[model samples]
Target: MWYNQFRKIQKAGDLMGMTVNKELPLPADLKSEEPLTADIIALKQKRDREIRDIFTGASDKFAVIVGPCSADNEDSVCEYVSRLAKLNDSVSDRLVLIPRIYTNKPRTTGAGYKGMLHQPEPDKAPDLLAGIIAIRRMHIRAIKESGLTAADEMLYPENRSYLDDILSYEAIGARSVENQQHRLTASGMDIPAGMKNPTSGDFSVMLNSVTAAQSSHNFIYRGQDVTTDGNPLAHVILRGGVDKYGTCIPNYHYEDLMRLLAQYQKRELNNPAAVIDTNHSNSDKQFKEQLRIVSEVLHSRAYNSELKKLIKGVMIESYIEEGCQPIGSNRVYGKSITDPCLGWEDTRRLILKIAEEA
Candidate 1:
């Protein structure tokens, strides 16, 4: 009787041509979190403390999370972060550098190379099982080799536990910021999580997300009832937004920052802070314009002490090379295959300049 009922439902759904395709291993089925070597654990803990301190007003160091738009090439990303590690030493007084090792990329149209979390090798077809292992290994290698605790997008809330032990910061992308699961997962995170303003550019939606993330909640996670104590380190990231006409309008200006500050003040949230994403719609995807955006935000911070206090840091999309290329046989090394990004030389100059200003 149960089989007949299932068959009836399946036949009914078949009228719409729906089919269950494949099932992949759960996180527990896949490789477990590797035991952190003493050195890596210490490095991660130290970096996590500095990041949390910045959010909590315990540390005045401006946190800068910079790297490629996606971790398409592991070697290139590792090399890029190694350089950032040396630079971090030079500017330890004023800035906290967290290299981005974002393995997941959210596509607007739901097509294209999804990111390292989908294709460990961009040119190859996605092997999810291999991709999971590869991303974890890459993140671990980045921390072990460079002493830089990295940041990654929480593109899949359920996958957070896979890297929970390794990542120092996590971000809910503009496309996923308004999602209930994303907000709830962030609420459980011990490290800082940034919730970006939605692509629709609604400040209220973003603030509401922050509120949700900073509140305690009980939810079902991985087939079990879990409770979160609320993540007080949840904050905002202003990545600009698209207008109704689909044109990119910037929100990194002094006026925009001030407006965000005003809205944040009215909210009853903890660790009220925001990070200016210099790339994306803010720079109109003109990768070179990121330099100017960063400089301008720094000027705004200098002009208003309150703004300075509210604005915690900046997120820059950068890699070894500048610009981007369509994923194909002839892709450029270190250039982004997703969004255009600032090249290494320009990125270094901007970081040093920001440190000087800070």
Candidate 2:
């Protein structure tokens, strides 16, 4: 195995209280090995534009970002997306379904599965090198076989370059939205980026993130100085919030939407919009409530023309089977190993309903 001799400052090993592992391949090397074909490249270009149009108000169709909470197994993920591709055709008229192939997840306590970046095989030990390749390969297969590029959370902003070409939409997770690096890095991307409100559910902090992502700036990234053109497609995602007492407080109601719209009007940000997360704090982890949550969001949109334009879409957590399980033996084929999901049957029914109404 080859390793880069990182400089002296890299010796933060002692300061950070962790051992240094071998360096992985550069983003370019990984792309070369698991390259996207010309046809796949063309597919992504077309799909990405459709997503951008939804946020820019140039298209009337809504965007539904759905799929597993964490893509732990490649075969299962591909199978899930293959089904989604077939479902997409039916709802293409009113909804643009962007599958969720989240490869990384944030743990409030900072333990457990860190996602495919730490353990490509959920039941196995951590292997950073293998994890990187696994995630890239899984993403490529999802696009090539399904003809649909998906959404992944930007948990590690520095690692986004590895899958930037393969992802149509990326979210700045609630845990990372307040970080300056995540905001600055988002400003340079061309794809649509959704900055979720922090766990505290503060709209001001969320709005500040949107403003920062929509403005150009200079910052050091990946060992070099750079400037960004600012992503006009950047926007907000209301995933609800958690209070000091750990209670889930949802913000997807009509009143919440109106309150957020008022907040957007107060800012100078471009492409003012929001995507309601049907899972998470919104559903309080009751994966089944995703259906009603989405319905409520659509209902709110229909109730107010002003809000109708502001609410571009929603994010749904779903998979082959419903619910989640602890990491161990005898796991369900399509069940989630991270957060619980809405499952396929419920997901299909909910999606079709969304198309008919949205």
- Root-mean-square deviation of Cα positions for candidate 2 versus the true structure, in angstroms: 2.5
Minimum summed lDDT over a 10-residue window in model 1 is located at: 13-22
Candidate 1 C-alpha lDDT tens digits along 124-234? 988877788888888888887888999999999998777788899999999999899999999999999999999988889999999999999999998789999999999
| Tens-digit per-residue lDDT, 136-232, candidate 2 | 9999988888999999999998898889889999999999999999999999999999999999999999989989998899999887799999999
Error of 2 at 141 (Å): 0.4
- In order, the Cα lDDT scores of the candidates are 0.90, 0.92
TM-score of each: 0.93, 0.96
Once fitted onto the true fold, the runs of candidate 2 whose alpha carbons sit more than 4 angstroms away are 1-16
Candidate 1 structure lDDT:
0.90
C-alpha displacement of 63 in model 2, angstroms?
Answer: 0.4
Clashes of 2: 1
Evaluated at residue 323, the lDDT of candidate 2 is 91
Candidate 1: which stretches are off by over 4 Å? 1-33
